[model samples]
Target: MIWRVATLSFLLTLSYLCFQPVKMEDGKEESMELGTQSQSQMDTSDSQNKGSNEVEEKNPSVEKSGEMKPDKTESDSGSKPTNNEKSANKTPEENMVEEKKSEKTVELKFPTTLEGFGYKFDEDGKLGDIETGEPFVFKVRSHDDSYNQKRYEALGEVITEYVYELLEKEANLKRVHIPVDASEGEAQSFIFMTEDALTNPDKLLLLIHGSGVVRAGQWARRLIINDNLKSGTQLPFIKRAVDSGYGVIVFNTNENRIRQGDKFIPVRESSTAVDHGLYVWEEFVSKSAARNIAIVAHSYGGVVTVELAIEKEAEFKERVFAIALTDSVHSLSHQEVSSSVIKLFKRIAKNWVSSKEPLDTPVPSRHRYECPQVSAGTNKHEETSWSSFESIFEMLDKAYKEVTEIDKEEL
Candidate 1:
């Protein structure tokens, strides 16, 4: 009887050892059955979550052990979702944008945020609408084309004026009036000045608007007319320049000639773009104790820049640090861009051109001899400035640092 009891006890010990849970590193005693159950529950939870957008839905199996699974939905497959699924993913802002885009008229609200580009997009990566302060996007639904054109033109002018006024109101900007040719008769050349810029500035950034109806603090006239302030105006650039410790100069080259005495004459203080640019450099830029000068010019402003550089080669060589031009119309053919000028440009200028390649990516340029031409990372002619702003400024900062370092080393 003693031997039988011992055999029975030994058999019981072996059975307990065989069924014991493996000891975990944390000294937790989990039964093998419990671990198997937990794993089964996890697998079930994952299966239940497959392509299901419902987050709070609890699995029935999870209530007992933690999991559930259902038939694979359309979202489970790695293939494109159906139109109905796309509609289901639409965000509130995206829906609003779609509704707004379809309407010929919308109540526009001025943008108050700088976190984003102010573009509304859907969950599926579709651009919905843009926020521009214009009250309506003019469209001629009726047959009166002439009347429609007139209506839009007047509205566009109003918006342009409104944006310019807004720029004038920015705290960092100061309005500096330059005298045009005394021959232009009482006309004044205006450039926006940032705070602390009237005196000697260590860094000066010149902002030149494109040609035509555009004025100071503007990149393109149609950006305001067709798009919004974000696209049309240079406020973003101005804000950035000011933040980056640069004295901002919004060059109003196109606003040189005015009608003061009946006949169109250059304002008493005004000159044409070419002459006005030169005059500004001589009077304000050259005189400013700016140790380093950089220029950001768009469109025809390139002509003004190159002409100024060629005219004031000595000043340019001595002070101008970098030049960033967007969709510049100035070509080397216009002025052979002499070897000396080309060398200076190669050392300092970066021409932002509209190309399919990514921003700042170098592209083959017919005028590479003039300067470094690269993709502004956008195909839109007007958008080149904004798209390349961060990248271009980064380059400028790097170059500036190098120059400063070299100066320090020389000392």
Candidate 2:
């Protein structure tokens, strides 16, 4: 009777435990319907706001020279046309006017609009939606005027700054401001590096873009602002370097001044391209512990590197390993390169120029003074950046390996 009573009590306890309610973190016993309820709430919210999101996506932000195109009218389009569908020759106004001239005047047929694209047909038949009747903030280059130069300069400034933002966000690179010639608490300019590139020394890849409007992380401003992001920015170069166990530093050799609050302060160390590049090299690059350093410079950047090789003779001999130039504009006319320097440079540097010539067709030796050039497998000057990427890395690898081997042999 005792065993029977104990067994019955144990079965009752097990049944009670199995049927107990589930408690939440807040100690409230929630209904099994809570999950379904939450899901239903999500479905309802998404359904409610889906239209607005679609409307926002339809309103594209596209403009050339900040010209406020008259808001498109219902009569202007039979159906909303995409960039590809639109006529190449017709203006937006002309397209609308064409749409208004219907073949059957007696029967007016209103075309159905795409979802989210709203066209307001006011009583006046004019476009109801309009942009601010304002000109672009600055004038860009035109065939007719010189005042447009400032506008071009401003555009370059905007592009260079935007490129920096993309580099950090897209490539996840870090920025460090190295004081140009000033001591602590004085004026400084910036250079970009990877997370620990400054401290780690294994392999360092320094990226220097061409002169003029293009700043660090870009080869051309027009492509960056006008073309696709991948074609414009140096994110590709950064990623490749990171993958190859190389720390990267994007040199801002052209930014001679920095903004402080409302006023702009000139860097004490840098006033020109040569000044800035030399300052960055002496202060930051010279201090790195990397056994070898490689550089990828484009266009006028080649000239800057050539100057560095000429000026910093001892430092270049000790630390530099490889240098690649895309469509380099380095010339003997600008400054003379000694025979000894040419011999030192030819061993590691390869100039990739925009030409129809073979990739290895040597630039005619100019009295053995100027650096020899090679075709980067492209003829377009601006396209050299994108075209020479593969060739640049190949040269860097071969030269870098040779450098490492020599160091090992010495060891």
Candidate 3:
């Protein structure tokens, strides 16, 4: 009977142990289900909070929950967050803020039209109507007899009209008028040159206008006519240079008025003026195939032209055959002349040093002068003088003759 009782006790204990394991397994499954439900609730709460924040940013101060008190009162009350209350919590707006700081900076490249590069000319490479072949003309003159305020105003009106007409008529050449301060005065100018003039030898001739003549619409018109005629009196120097197998282009310097002392007008440095001219020249060059260039500048343009030559001498020397300056105020420097002596000796020392070497070893020399090649002329009157147009013409003619002679000798 004792043995049987002991066996029964052992079986009972073993059966209880087995049943305990099943009960523990069922409890673990229930715990896992509770954890999963908790996680799902948290995820749904986060989504709802994000949506609420977005709405608050748009509307500001809209209640998200019916039971919630005012934000300021809830902050002061120090209430503990319940499980449901925790679900409504919103992330700080500062954390949600999109910084929007650009990590990749974009560089802008300007647009270039076929006409923008100076390609507006025809087979002859002239600035005329493409359909009719008739050269564009302008009435570029002062408003009245005097070079006073009224005269300048009238001049400005004419210029405006001419520019409008040119843009309206020419589909090939695009013109942009960069305006300075209108309140100060009428400071505006335009650029006109064939896009292919720099690269195409058939289209060579970069024309840069000097101070007063730059704004005169007649200057560009005359230049165009001269270019078309190829033997006209308007730009005889340009025609001569072109005939000698050189390309031409033109730029308008910043200073447009002829008045001697205008405080309002800004005085540009020689370097700045030259750079502006060159900037336009390079634009034409980038689009064309012609390499050889001859720059023809008049008066103040002379200074601008020389600056460009000096600045781009190494590059231009191989390509630019010659530069013609007409009645220019600026002086030229010799290759041998040092910067220290340039101010005192001017062109004389520079010329002497350049010519000194070639004199002793000449084999039937073609160039007659021993000096650095420069053709300069001056009218007897002061810069402010309104002299006879004939005297100006004579000075220009003599200067042209000297330049051609130099070119012939050098070539």
Among these predicted structures, which one has the highest lDDT? 1
User: Which tens-of-lDDT digit does each residue in 362-406 have in candidate 2?
Assistant: 555444555566765555455567777887788788888888888
Better of 1 and 3 by lDDT: 1
Native RMSD of candidate 2 (Å): 28.3
lDDT of 3 by residue, 1-411 (tens): 465334434432322222121112212111111210110110000000000011111212222333344445345346865433553464444222211111013221221332321224455646443454544322111121121222223333343344434433442233444332234444444454433444464325555544432331223322232243221112344334344454444455543332445544433221234555666655554355664455555444555555555555555544444444333334433222234333322321111111112222222212332223321111110111111123333433454455557668999
lDDT of 2 at 263: 84
Count of clashing residue pairs in every prediction: 13, 1, 18
Query: How many angstroms is residue 310 displaced in model 2 relative to the true structure, after the best TM-score fit?
Result: 2.4
Candidate 3 local Cα displacement, residue 203, angstroms: 6.0
Candidate 2: worst-modelled 10 consecutive residues by lDDT: 41-50
**RMSD, candidate 1, Å:** 27.8
Better of 1 and 3 by TM-score: 1
Q: Which stretches of candidate 1 lie over 4 Å from their true place?
A: 1-135, 180-185, 261-263
Ranking by TM-score: 1, 2, 3
Model 3 residue 216 distance off true place after TM-score fit, in angstroms: 7.3
lDDT, candidate 1, 1-411, per-residue tens: 465334434432332232333433432223333211111110000001111111222222212111223335545564876544554578866754554453335332322322122333233322223553222323322322333344444444454555566777854576777673333345565777776665645788888876655678777544454445666678888887777888877788877676656766564434566777887888788778778888998766787788787788887988888899886766554453467777888888988877768787886767556688888876656667877879878887987898788879999
